[model samples]
Target: MAHLAACAPLGACTTKQNASLRSQSARVVPRAHHADGETQAASPALTRRGALAAGIAAASLVLDAQESGAVGFKKELKDKRRGRTRIPEEEYTKELQDGVKYVDLEEGTGEVVKKGTKVTAHYDAFFRGIDASSSRQARFLNENINLPEPYDFAAGSEIRISKSKELPLPPQALTIGVIGMKPGGKRMLLVPADPWGYGDKGYAEVPPGATIEVLIELLSIGEA
Candidate 1:
């Protein structure tokens, strides 16, 4: 009689356990109904795919907007360049090769820039233009004077502010422009709208066909 009483409670417990498992499974597994009234468990794989597709679409839209904005900005720059006139060559003190011109503001007395020397300097750039009367003015574009560190590059290589470090060390215009410059010297260069000055492709905020007026202050010279 004792064993029978124990067996009866065990059977009741098993029944209760089965009932609880069924209730939990029903709550956890969602069902989907088809048009023909066939019911099936909802697919977690399908839910994940839907979410992935939505994320990709949102990302594509953001990319498209960014591309559109860049294109619009480039067009605006081109239009602005078309309306501007070049500054007269006589305004500069001396002319270097390839039509690059410079006027010495303050001559440096420290070290001369030579081949393979790394030059460090702070610079301010402007877009130069003239009016119908041939009077020229510089419109400020960018500057690195307030920055804690100055630009350091090879003396005879190309340097574009908008480009990465992969570009050649400095532009020929700059190389020739800084030929006699020493530490603490300042010079203003009028770079022509050629390959030396971003060329027809232009640089960030510098319009196409724009002549760049750069005021460079020589800070230091070191071996590369």
Candidate 2:
């Protein structure tokens, strides 16, 4: 059941996508904004040609984007072996041996990752990687490798970019990547499935595909 067995994994790598991520036409949407940074808000939604390239995919930000929430991003610090946590045990065992499949969702207050830290996250990335349905599945598929990045990514399996079953997506809605990391610093990224737009061969809202989610952060370096 590891998917991609032969059929329905990506439906034989289907093709017929005329362009996704919200049908682009080529930047120029901004209209206002200029007070502190001194004018810069033409808002083609902050351009790069809209979501990367706009069709099939161009932005989901990170690129296994399977480390989201309820593993709940936390905060608090002090250390010797264990005494503070907002997620820190060598950054939670280097995010579970860098395979992205760990979930300990409780037992906090033992943070200690010195260097000038700052972290903030609220994620959701599930099309079929298992974040709920509790039975005994926790190795680190809680998804969120910083959300928002696009410029021609192509939405094959889980890099989908379909969003618009009529327009109704607002579940903790995400965005806020690149801040400051270097105080015991660590950074991991992925999530570029074209703005989590699921579509290309994926159905049932988000399955038949699943890839994007791996946002790890542990900054303290230059504090900004």
Candidate 3:
């Protein structure tokens, strides 16, 4: 993405505005034409004034371009979200589907997850050991459960949820795997790497194609 200043041409200034800007520039930077056809040099003060005026014009253009870009970007995001294919709501069940194996530690009596529902949960993720051996260490990867307060999902915990518009969103292993879960439920999910657990592009300490275990405790569900 280009900076606002760099996208000034994208501002698309109107003809009237362009003419007005040219007139202002001409007034600030006067050129004296001699009878002998020699051009007289402008005064130092006038030169500085012209430069300042030009800078202000550029700044205004940058501001306009930035505002336009911001508005367009927001609209595009909204439209994209609207056009997205919504995942169908699943029937309430304890059975896990889509290659996601889960073990429910505590059953929830709250509302079940449906389309457009917003859910808040605290999770602890760990790199699963080979062959489910008791001797193998399941190294801790990340957690969002030890905070004093929740942010956007769990606030005031110094752990702010990222609103990044980047590619490859959070792992579907958790998002899709958590479908049909109700608030107050606790489940341990066994997530495979390909197309689920970071899709072969392992993040941070987790290696590529690594399997992971996520212990999730659902907090609340509300209207999105």
Per residue, candidate 2 scores C-alpha lDDT tens digits across 1-224 of 01122334554533433232123323334445556655454655457566556732533433214233322242111121121223332443323212333233322233532222333322333333322111111122344222222211111212123454222221111222222222233333333334433334443344433443333232222222
Supply the TM-score for candidate 3.
0.41
lDDT of candidate 1 over 21-117, digit per residue (tens): 6676556656788999887778999888989999999999999999999889778755543434444567796886677888888887876888677
lDDT for residue 2 in candidate 1, whole number 0-100: 11
Candidate 2, after superposition: displacement of residue 113 in Å?
5.5
Clashing pairs for model 3 are: 150-154, 150-155, 151-154, 151-155
Model 2 TM-score is 0.16
lDDT of each: 0.64, 0.30, 0.55
Winner on lDDT between 2 and 3 is 3
Q: What TM-scores do the predictions have?
A: 0.47, 0.16, 0.41
**Which is better, 1 or 2, measured by lDDT?**
1
Which numbered prediction scores highest in lDDT against the true structure?
1
- Which of 1 and 3 is the better model by TM-score? 1
lDDT of residue 113 for candidate 3: 70
Query: Stretches of candidate 1 above 4 Å error?
Result: 1-89, 129-148, 160-172
